[model samples]
Target: SDVIEFPSSIGKVTFTHKAHQELLKDCQKCHASPAGGTIAGFDKDWAHKTCKGCHVEMKKGPVSCKECHKK
Candidate 1:
């Protein structure tokens, strides 16, 4: 089947609808365009660099290796 965004990627990341809905009070909170102000949404300036950028700023980006992969 064709992937929604990146079809040629190694594999598709499955979504946990119920869990996400329960976890995230607002979809726009995490999924938004450049008009919402969050780097996840707006693209105005460095102020809003999105989750990845924000996390990186906090020394918590995925590149940290231990942020989410800690044992």
Candidate 2:
């Protein structure tokens, strides 16, 4: 799917796969090695670390609670 929604207690996080693919152009960045399938350890901390960490490093994307976790 182009867009994936993650339901959370704080809010629903809507992720645009196509956008990231176009921007990063690397499946390994978010996927597993060798083939790009399910992530190894996916969880809240992992998301905050990998996803938000990337945003922080790249100086783009949402990095705040309200920015990602919408009510």
Best by TM-score: 2
Off by over 4 Å in 2: none
What TM-score does candidate 2 get on C-alpha atoms?
Answer: 0.90
- The CA lDDT at 57 in model 1 is 63
> What's the distance in Å from true for residue 46, model 1?
17
Task: For residues 3-69, write the lDDT of model 2, one tens digit per residue.
Answer: 8888899998988988888889888898877366667778889999999999999999999988988
Using lDDT as the measure, the top candidate is 2
lDDT of each: 0.39, 0.87
Task: Assess candidate 1 and give its lDDT.
Answer: 0.39
TM-score of each: 0.31, 0.90
lDDT of 1 by residue, 1-71 (tens): 12112121333333244454465456564556423332332332322254346457656434332332333
RMSD per model, one decimal: 8.5, 1.2
Clash count (model 2, backbone only): 0
